[model samples]
Target: MGGFFSKLGLSCGIFCALVARFPLSAQTKQAQNPVIFADVPDLSMIRVGGNYYMSSTTMHMSPGVPIMKSTDLVNWRLVSYAYDTLASNDAMNLANGQSTYGRGSWASSLRFHNGTYYVSTFAQTSGRTHIYFTKNIEKGPWKAVSFKPSYHDHSLFFDDDGRVYLVYGGGKLRLVELTADASGVKPGTTEQVLIENAGAPAGPNTGLPAEGSQLFKIKGKYYLFNIVWPKGGMRTVVVHRADKLTGPYEGRVALQDLGVAQGGLIDTPDGQWYSYLFRDFGAVGRIPYLVPVTWADGWPVLGTGGKVPETLALPASKGLIPGLVASDDFSRRPGAPALPLVWQWNHNPDNALWSLTNRKGYLRLKTGRVDTSFVLARNTLTQRTIGPTCSGATALDVSQLKDGDFAGLALLQKRYGLVGVKRTKDTKSIVMVSAESEKPVEIQRVPLTQNKIYFKAECDFTDRKDVAVFFYSLDGKAWQKIGAPLKMAYTLPHFMGYRFGLFNYASKNAGGYADFDYFTISEQISKE
Candidate 1:
């Protein structure tokens, strides 16, 4: 009901009284910056009723365009995806050495119209613009329709007169009116350039111009927010305001701290305004940050004193379980999703290859093709590895694995690492492989004697000094450290964070499958 300081003061009061009974843990309840510490980039968010809903880009991953819900804008949980799969081309299917690793879907725009929740995004790989609408946002049977000619970094705006408009484009901004149903642009209604160079002083830079346009109409004035990277400076925020929808507009730099720019404004029910933007923080990918906004001279100014605050309004932290991150047991009910919302495929998944009910209480991953590398392996399940440190462990039932099948836990990227079981025609062994700079390197290997081998990958992204270490267990209680450390990276080639992935690929043969009993993630400090 109050700010973080007030909540902390109250907790301290209760702590003093309970000191004689129990000891308080060391983790603090302070709300920190980079509200979400994972790779939730190109964010588009909206507030509905009592909840804040956010949509983010997941690129080539199946079940793309993740929609997360948060009550306090800091503690977000994945709710649904706009599409189960992009399903447009072979690249989306990871076929023929072609993959949509970094080019499927990018920044999304989320909005609530009347009673339906709408999420719109364009995929560069698909060359299409998709519009999804649902009456229920959380659990949705979203009706989807797509059209040719993709719109880049666009915002979906519903005008007061019930007209639909798409505010999109590069430095020379354009607004195209849509049909009454919002299915497509009105025929013969040519686009209008809304703003020129967004009124920049040095004009738009050719290398990194003004893009990611989000439009808003507040209190009879039209506002456009965009991220502009000047030729020699850091990422900047430019806000253009016009009294009419088609402007005649003037603009200014609104917020520009720590490269946190390119997002629109949202006001709470109680009238508190905040800007939800993201910052590029090295190999962990672009992390989202929420900045408080204040109205000055009828214009929204971002950040306090033009500086990013370390601690903002604190929301209740429920420690990333059953919410942002989950430890799956692979048990499905009568009519639930085959996998939890927290899990996504590395690219488009082979729907028939993995199952939860195939073997009760276990996840069965069957290989459909013979692939030499993990990057080309389809159906490698993945989830974001949160910072400062977390360990992802899985109990692998390798008794049924075929020869040439590699099953284990992975920290997946263009350059990645894995601690998994490699089964041959007659033998099984545990091994570690990593890719630091050029390509994947075999760091270490250990011969295994048991069928149920446990693999764990501990990732540390604290302060962006990203690194990962591998471990293995035979009894599930005693752990042995193995493999050389991995320098986790956020490379633009992959355009994603280091994710804890469950990968099983075939090399020498196909039809080899592995059953994973469970995957567990917990906070841990590296023994190093």
Candidate 2:
């Protein structure tokens, strides 16, 4: 058999060689700007040895504060998350009318000090500043520490003198010292106003104030990075420098093009510096951008010729698919994770309501209670929707769905759009619902005859033309457009980008369930 296969030129070594060559060609020698084209915003990055680690905000998404790892800074993959559930509350549980839709944990600061990895974030819903620490970041069983009064867009910094501090606030930045273990604020240390009018450097006319403070100590000088928005202008990068950890600090406007601001810095192993920031790119959310940095007369100048470049000297992108966001077949072997790292719940999930073991090769989401709207539905497994265009396709097994159960795929935002199977007492309908207005309006409904259904949500964020359309099919091969185009907008209420989600919730009765066979994501949108 081996000799016959060799004669046909189908040897195992030949097949393995072809597979190895594909991945190598996927990553180019030079990197591209907007390093990641997903909703990875408010980035805080750190370099430990040759590896670069980053953390980003995912407000209201449980398994919050996603930690990502990269070797060349362009190609990254999700490693772990800081917490499984941020807080256990009525809002987090999707109970009552209260929902932490846009008000969960905000920005996070990731740091490594003395062999311990630390990530800190603040939550308005929980009203606390949370600090999580682990000896191992990749495989973390992190321990949590909480304190009252959450800080806004704070940076956790470890000074050279062994003192830890948190620099935070908006417009006017403030500072507070943390204890040795970073449990709480140091005993007698009062919150001091660090930079009074931190936004002043940008100009007198300001729309969005300076916030998202990330401080770094480079070459014995303290450098502070913040984002400021000038009136009638875009999001801008402002930097401050101080000889001491505390003021008096001098400020300057760094990079203002393309509204790409609000992140910190990371250095390469070979001594090259880069500014890590994000741009608010419509409904696709705030995508990350990498700007080359150079020191000019003691100041770190951002971008090339004072503009964000489209490409860089670093390694090229290996793409975000199967890394930042991926397709899941819901099949897992023993000892493997129930869901991939790319997936996150809409909010704190009810562990008892979801399982991969209840049925082999399927994700079973049982409705524990009734939800009035799709936004309040629990157990909605989600991943970031990427740009310039992408589509999320799912095969749902609705044979077990009870009356009043709704199960399908959704493009989740404040004003969301969904294509799913909605069952009533007498009939099952394939419905397309758009919540572009105040209430969810069922745009179209077709009678669903079969138990198994295929649903897809295609999003186009090209040139900031944010639009999404829903499609449904009895067979996975052929699709029919179902609804009015969803005019995707970046609303402040959600505070995050749109996510492709698999959801099942009850409108009237509980205990109804839906099984998802698989969720597949494609970088290209398919035409019906």
Candidate 3:
């Protein structure tokens, strides 16, 4: 029997060698772990069947609450949007050209219960909360349900006893029980589980209000996780657990100070749990960060050891989970599409203005009139800056534009911090300029005609308060100083990091479009 087994092993080895030598097709590689999907913030995820569904706050961008689907914890793709029309004409008219940076939906909660999917968001304009539900996740003809505004960062909690509750606000944590129909709060059913000024280690600070509440049950104890802001600083996630779902809960710090942390807990089928956190990387705005969570005593802890871990080795997911890759080379591949995960717009996105077709090998952006207000109209393709010190490069050809046409790259921080190349018919020259809050101050204007120009912007976020911006004309050639390095700290009410992208603004109508060869973003990793 030993001799026969040895012969069988040798025969199997020979067979494997032959198969390798005469391979039918290229072997598919297993997806990498901790796949980075940049700029996805305030992440709320739920496991449905064998798939994971996640959603984040869309702000003023149309199609609010971007719903993403994933098989493994990592590798997410945009599936659908919760709100079809983000802000209608009526909603925008109410905004009145003001920026809704902190006012829009901060953090949103997504949950699937009893074969139905539910999502809730805190709309600041009306000072009211709205919940939407759909029978199917992908194709959502979502119906909206309105309630009194508790606060931003709202979440839904379903008790095991067939009762539902809504938890929201940070400073004054409000929890109200709901009827089974989820129509309105149960008659005479209202409770304030945690008050901001009452039970805090330190007194409640101004501006640094608490909000973004989430409830989870572990080890038969219910934990209420929420964000707390302490007197002019970035908000952090904290938790308080109680023996009963609704009770006099004790507040404890789960995640503190450490940059900005939002989002909540998601449990995999295998019982492993993780919490999503957001960090503000200058020029990247707030990007998502995942941390392994564990329950200690009764409080929850994030990261590996109180410190936020940059990367980790996650357990292999049981089945195949898709990966997140918004990068495009424009060389038509089997599954490659023009639409990426990062592109967003105010109001409904016009599909006619953008496309990836055989005629244009690059992403062609049609020139349109600049929206008088940044919040109202700006045709820009942007992605979050995930690293403090990162660089983005893109190749653009604006030769088709007549005078008064401008197309270039930019590093955006809300209404300010825009640096790029522009072209006007006056001189038929491509000028490099920087805009701080939509005020375009000429930097360095250069001439380029009928040639595809390469543009790059590097943001030194080591000192985000004083960010430096530099531009390069070609891939690896002469680098020119565009303008005086500007201080970005005072640009907005809340100073978040910068975002990079390609934008085209036309003061006068231009017949042609701006064609982009490609856009690439890279973050510098600290050696430590």
Candidate 4:
């Protein structure tokens, strides 16, 4: 027995030595800054056992609040969504000349309790607060409950005593109690002010007052996190702590670097803490950043030495491409979904007008109704455009297009750019449209003779230099630049980052259709 044990110990030592000598890439763990270099913002994260789940704001996009899952804090993948359609209305449906472009859903708060998961968000367009709950987080038929009075930038908290509450509001923070089931406000519970001057921690002259509230109870104390932008200053993080849920709280400035604010706290299984926040990175929009957290005399300290670090001790990210945003061949096997979770419609889509099985291995977008412009067009499929730089290409078949049909690839935003085949009564022409101002203008138009063509849009967001260019190809290998360059701007109307979209719309007729063979994405721009 002693000889056998000695041999086992010697083998273990040899294995350790070999592992040290080899040092596999998976064993090398060091994460870089801006953990996810994509436009995933307004984050609310929760850790269950060894897995972490996050819910973020997607504004007017259908399947509104996106839920992402990650085992390590660095890499994440989309798991599910909170709701399919926020509401069946004119604006949400993009009908009657009204659109919910930037006003559907705002910040969301996610929590889990008693084996039930809850995600709450408020929409200014709907003018209400929506709370969705389910037993299964990944595959869920979530049930919803809505109430009047939209809560802005709220946090859903479940107390130890089985009471539920919502801490929310703007410069002057407020609190309200919910029913035990969290369906609505608790009876006889009056809404009251929690902190009179929540933005005072950052300074008195505040421009964007203290908002984006996230509340937590850690070790018998209630801590509230918020973001504030003082006059002539950048976005800052402020924390307010109290001995009780309702009390005279003490406030202080937590993190004031790189405009990386507006998120809450999360901890790992190994007991390390982090603050998941975001920064405004030009046209790519708000990208997530993780700052290490340490407790100092019971207050959580954010960042290292008052600054966001360039790297972290967590595992290295495997990248977001093909996971968060993927190239779709529109091919599926038996009993498979027609569209993947990475794709989202601009708004509530007209499902009957778009299909994958219409033509095998092709996404056929058939026009259901005639519309005036691209923004008003229904059933526009989209994917978030990622950063430093990225490009999306698609092979379009305009053979089935009818007169007055416009179908192609585009970078969809308030100020947009697109390259597509436009059909008229007598001829077919390839046109490039740019909406840098109040109205869209045809920047360039070239007559086309082929039935099939490829279109691509490349976006450059390096160092906040937001620019995009369009290109077209006849043979799919060689590409030609077309149209004026798009000076991409993060406008208030969109309230989100630019997205690669496949759009088909008709101006004079409604029976036209466009077939897309494949959509591909690369992290490199063509000019690079």
Candidate 5:
């Protein structure tokens, strides 16, 4: 990947100009909270030498457990994935009307020890916890290892004594030992309760009890971080400390600002330590925020005066676009890969159903089988739809589409809005469907004779007034509003932000395909 720019004939001056276009970190500029603003949740980060690598949870989306790299902690780019596929399950493949929207994989733990990188994630759909290890973290052929009985939000810790352990479980935190090879649990080793209710000294938890547990040994003292929701309160961060690995631990509240909790820690080479946490920003999924950590009296304290600062003594944000979101021409450069890392399939996609090289400059999405709904569609390419104000547009060719095929741009979520070309046995037509409140209902339709068309969806999330509008174009320059305003929402069923998706699904026939020429995004003035 390092040679990608060189293959594209980008000179040093051009590269420097491109770097200058990205966000600049001034000497006085402080890193803002929510460093990476996308649905990068359940984060577990580690610093390898001068480079920082973070593994995050992208549940149900194929190429799971995304590994991101950043020179500065603020700007990150997706480099690799721990697993290309989770498992062969009906829920994972969107079969039998079942989907693994929020339950495929959860809260991953990333670690680097003894010149090797390890990432552990649990999948409810497969009922197993997978451990992936690689010598080279960025470029890889990562090997997979899994065990039965998935532990909820577990942490993988390797101690100095050559002992490997898994610290896992919910309100009652438990610890179990693994074989030296990390194949499975060591038999006859007693699994002990590490912390009861995450040692919440307050009353019994009224909200979600202690969960999202991550353990770390800092300064030769064991420290564990967990997120708990108090009664009628936001998500809170709780930390516990102990001298021994498996002993009685003391606990306290670490942070409570906007529910940014539940990640491990990373330190700079210069010895500055910070806790990587995430907050649930509506419609954009869980966004990661960095908090400064200082040691006082042998305990790692978070933030200033128990409050999360808006800015930190680190690199400024690069605006979550360059790496996380991008405008693509669907054309591969001299040595470019077929697709950018920013794109992901809705679920485990049928590899044979999509291609970029098959058609020189267009993305060809072929339907593998018949589907009843969009949720059951097999190949839906998606990217994060950033908030405040943004719009995504795509031009699609429906000439090769068979009857009952719907191919177009969609704002995908539980309650989604779709503007696409729906082909019938006799004619082709453009339709707009909105799932603003109830199930999707068609709001408008336009009969089409041409085989190609352009579509766009604009989203506004300023002041939490989430809404989406759809538009269509006969010519690329002339656009027409075609649908009622969709009251966009962030629902738990999807458990994700609104994503701009290019989807092709067969409602009746099977071998239909669509060609997407390009996809572009533009940030607009806030509609607040």
Candidate 6:
């Protein structure tokens, strides 16, 4: 037995060393490079002084615009939200127990100029683009500016000569030079620079439809990085350059068929340039991908394929920035916040709705209005799906729930698949799972000895078909399984990845709250 153990240990060490010494391919290198944000789509990034700030499209989820801050181009933390409320009631009317993952915010832009941070969003349902500006990026006193730019995936860029321009519209690219005051478009500045009907071979689906336009000037040449949506296919990133800010620019392919391209240009101090792209992982929504840009013969070659590289040599190690950490301890440690980088709200959030106080050692979420749709409603605590094969666990104390009050942990993929635990007056507590059109299937119902409860849900993405497992605990140890594994698939129409977090709903008449503590996630590995 000792010989066997020693051999096994040696094998493991050899495997680890092999993995550590393996040379990353050019494609793998690009994919493994650390990015400040992950899984966030339609990114617009800007450099302010020495810090970098970024924002991405937040579909129906409230606290609409998520703002992140980082010193290096790699590590990022959620700093604040651009909008606190959904601003529209249509989002609140989604069918009860439905998932709305891929339908809300599309591509957005974040820019800093003249002591203000400007953000623009395309609300698909509204079909109108809106822009907001704030003097401070961290603590916003934001003001909304209205412009009926009937388009999606908009971006703003300021030229070297201090000229502002808006690039947007789909199927074609539009550029409108803005006046010096940044109030409106300059006279005769509107022009359609590139049309999808022009050059470029038709993809297996369809050729790229221009979108997500960001203008930049390098070496006196104007470059526009545009997001292209192939007909009936995934998103691609393409670039066009011109000698003049407004002109007949030449278009070249940057990234093709990698995923949806969002976010704009992000550069390191060492003069290395990378564009943050997004990949749609259904239920996981859109996650961030980094593509390194190198100029060759005066044209940009993204990744290494003249197309998006799936992998590449990792960024130079000297000035390397660490990737975002997925674990959370909830210790709060004086200055730490409770939420992680993946968490987002539909609208702006009020600090009073949450806290880490007393000896609770848990997240306390007060019950708010119970609206069927999460898109327009407030008081939802949610996070993005980080890994393909992972499990999330959280302990909840629901002793305070009233008759119609329910608090539980959920694995949500929009209005699609959901598995959770809820407390009721008659049942005490029950474990349930449901999908977009499927009925709420009860997995287990158990009477509670104490009002407080501990709950957990594990999502196993190891299998081709993702499986979700639910469990509950009374003392935070001895856990009991609630049901057979619930199977899920990413190929389902509108289905996305699973998001794990806590939520609560109160009857209009019942005033209640749900407290959650000790949330943790683990990566699954092969078992002997």
Clash totals for all candidate models: 1, 0, 9, 0, 0, 42
> Whole-model lDDT for model 1 versus the true structure?
0.85
lDDT of each prediction vs. the true structure? 0.85, 0.91, 0.63, 0.93, 0.86, 0.61
For model 2, which pairs clash?
none
RMSD of 5: 6.2
**Candidate 4 residue-wise lDDT, 392-462, digit = tens:** 99998999898999999989899999999999986888899999884899999999999999999999998
Give the winner by TM-score: 3 or 5.
5
Candidates sorted by lDDT, best first: 4, 2, 5, 1, 3, 6
Q: Which 10 residues in a row give candidate 4 its minimum summed lDDT?
A: 20-29
- Candidate 6, 166-201: lDDT as tens digits: 777765666666676555557777566554432242
lDDT tens digits, residues 147-181, model 3?
77545566788877889888766567777887786
For all the candidates, what are their Cα RMSDs to the real structure?
A: 5.3, 4.1, 6.8, 4.2, 6.2, 6.6
Q: Which stretches of candidate 4 lie over 4 Å from their true place?
A: 1-18, 21-29
Q: Pick the candidate with the highest TM-score.
A: 4
Number of the candidate with higher lDDT, 2 or 5:
2
Q: RMSD of model 6, in Å? A: 6.6
User: What does candidate 2 score in Cα RMSD to the true structure?
Assistant: 4.1
In terms of TM-score, which candidate is stronger, 1 or 2?
Answer: 2
Q: Candidate 4, after superposition: displacement of residue 468 in Å?
A: 1.0
Clashing residue pairs in candidate 3 are 170-210, 170-211, 283-497, 283-498, 283-499, 284-385, 284-498, 403-425, 404-425
Predicted structure 2: lDDT: 0.91
User: Which of the numbered candidates is closest to the native, going by highest lDDT?
Assistant: 4
Candidate 1 lDDT over residue span 150-242, tens digit each = 999999999999999899888888999888677888888889988867638435553467799888899999998998887767888889999
